[model samples]
Target chain A: MIENMTEIAISQLLSETQKMKYEDYRFVTASCVSLGDDGCDVIYHFDKDLEMKHLKLRVGKGEELPSVSKIYFCALLVENEMKELFGINITDIAVDYGGHMLLSDEELESPMAKQQITIVEKKGAK
Target chain B: MSKTVIPFGPQHPVLPEPLHLKLVMQDEIIVDAIPAIGYVHRGLEKLTETKEFTQNTFVVERVCGICSCMHALAYCQGIESLMNIEIPDRAKYLRVLWAELHRIHSHLLWLGLLADAFGFESLFMQVWRNREKVMDIMEETAGSRVIISVNTVGGTRRDISKEMLTKISVIVDEIKEDLKQVEAAFFNDYTVKHRLVGVGVLTKEDAYALGTAGPMARASGIKQDLRMTGYSAYGELDFEPIIEQDGDSYARTVVRLKEVYQSINLIKQCIAKMPEGEIVVPVKGNPNGEVVSRVEQPRGEVLYYLRANGSKTLDRLRIRTPTFANIPALLHMLPGSQLADVPVLILTIDPCISCTER
Candidate 1:
């Protein structure tokens, strides 16, 4: 189980990350999980002397959230990855790949989002 | 002076994998390097959701050819953690034995590539020739050379016998002796130092701020190593994370070399303390809830996030590889270096494009 995971509102994420940076915490990568209905949870991992802290942010489908790349420059690639894979519209990325960070134009868009499967299952239930 | 843009590899002779970088340059010095990857994006993580949680071990193992066992180990560890399963002591030590062997060969393989990057073909061949000894040990113990799928959700699938342990001790000594001979070439050669010493310097501040891992972070002044957290038998083993203050390409080289010996020592310790018992436990039910499993792979730290909703299939499996974490550092190191040293800088990262894309 992941301990010390403190859930923060999406609006408070940027400030919390800035606080982590000021406290000398190194920014680890972030992971995005689709929560059906195009909504998702973005967990930003940070470390200080090998101790990890996880911050979770929720984005409802086409919603936009602030990027931590401004506070922690290392977050650029991972943020870009979440942008492309899960279609989380994290605005103001340090270097935006514009949804092609890890995928090509020919590939399926937001390939990792769980909406398709959820939609199919919901229709079956109905 | 007009600026120039040079494309460096979706296919380059020096690169073992496809990683393209658009070098924004002025004359011979690189002003910026914009990396482009995805030529071989396999979508392995997405594929894992389809397979049963137990079978996903083999799928995750294929994430990186070099750190295959570590990938399986991390996945198994995650599933085990989510299920609240306590693995046996003997199995924990067995996991360490195989994991460190992977480390030995991986660092050795990178050393050979580093030599090849600087036009030292003979040194490259010699180092690889020595590396084959470690590979022989793996093939003997695991019945496979790379990607030995020995880890399971509860514990390990295979165990090493007393005879194999004795053989490993003898072979590890031989590998250490062989490494000493190559060490002279890497450390004493004037040209090797000239290529590495001051080239591709990443300051301690940049390394930490950018979240560099493994040798890259240790090469700088940071003392961050996941082994200190002691996920496997590492807590019982007597070893320390090698530290280098230089934070240059040379320091990175030195750290990896020293770690080669560290891995050998770890293998010997695991053999000496090899507990005799069951290799695997009966793990019942599916993983539920969320957990993050972290392991120190040869290149750096690898993170696995797993969530399951009381079913055989996992709901989510996210992998964050070290090479992915290190790319920002790779971009940070690229600019301001001479064009000729580009190969060394890229090779210094020991880029596993397969792992990054996954």
Candidate 2:
């Protein structure tokens, strides 16, 4: 069964994550999504006993969010991915890649950001 | 002894996908292993932002050719939940049938690759030869050997008739019979035991703490399987998660080998209990909410998070592939391992770089 989506303030992200860890929920994965002009929403998924609990944090473009990599070591990969792909300024990640983890030096910068090229659809008579 | 650095992939004989592991070795033992991925990242998740939700099934299926059906399944389930459409019972059984078939083929493929990793050439060929039967079944049933695009948003695109189901059942039984020899070789063969046993061990604690999934987690005695969640028809089926406590490369191999038989049994049960109904239901309106769908892929549990904004396209399509989740466990298992065993250890996790990177 699906659990209700829980929205938490950016300030409560760490404390809530710690509580989940104390409750023995396995850190599944973290997802970062661009919400256009309304900044971005970072959802952290955790699971225990086959039930899922999601803790979401919404932040502005220039906001520096805290990383949960220290609590959930596996979050390193996803955290670095967010920093590189979406330009999310994650603070004090455990195994920080300095913005070069998944992407290369030559690729497009922060492709998931709002200023990225928009994919336009062309209509044609078939 | 002086430390030597070895770059493991991005192009390697043993790896079919590009995953570079920077190995820091002290003589014959690897002290550390740092993984560098993204060599083959196609940005398929980003593509979902542009492609229509219906069309993205094909795109997501290409995430990994090996576990394409599971990828499609997860994406379709998420979209179906968003649209609040109940798939037909027949479609659910058909999905389980095809999913089990995919599992069997994927395990067989890993068996072949594992055999090849340890220089068991003839055994590798035999395992793959058996795998061809499954591939042929998929081609005949789904019209594609790899990347079967049978799943849509509401339901499946193809339906298997009772006659075809009987044919599949016969083939599955034949496969089970053929697998005895393969299982025997994996269990009794000296070379395989010597190379795999007590190598690349990850204890139960490390397995959970690092969040490993699928066979890797099962091998470590976690008793974690997404199938237990009962997405689709798995809840209706009678089965148990295969577990091994040894938590070694050999244990991982055994888990997968036994799971192949488990998948065969699951398919037979699905055919016996499959309900008769329409395969696809009409789904109207756009998805306006978010949903996270989880499915048990051959490698592990794959999570697809889809957010729709009441549009034809999705706002975000995030895939937490099994391989990506297993990377931390890989990093943990690498150190304290002999340099020569790196290939076998990497294969033990069934590293799908394309899936991980995408």
lDDT of each: 0.88, 0.88
Q: Best candidate per TM-score, number?
A: 1
Q: Give the poorly placed runs of model 2, Cα more than 4 Å off.
A: A116-126
Q: TM-score of candidate 2 restricted to chain B?
A: 0.99
lDDT per residue (tens digit) for residues B1-358 in model 2: 7899999987888999888999999988889888888777888888889999989999999899888999999999998988889999989988998899899889999999989989999999999998999999999999999888889888899988889889989998998888896778899888789999999999998899898989999999988898998889999999899999999999999999999999999999999999988999998989888889999999999999988889999999999999999999999999989988989999999989889888
Instruction: Give per-residue lDDT, candidate 1, residue B289.
Output: 95
State the displacement of the C-alpha of residue B332, model 2, in Å, after optimal TM-score superposition. Answer: 0.3
**Proportion of native contacts present in model 1:** 0.87
In candidate 1, the residue pairs with backbone N, CA or C atoms under 3 Å apart (3 or more residues apart, or in different chains) clash, namely: none
Residue B214, candidate 1: C-alpha displacement in angstroms: 0.6
lDDT, model 2: 0.88
Span of ten consecutive residues with least summed lDDT in model 1 chain B: B140-149
Per-residue accuracy of model 1 over B84-171 as CA lDDT, tens digit each: 8999999999999999999989999999999988889999998899789988988888888887889998998888889989999998
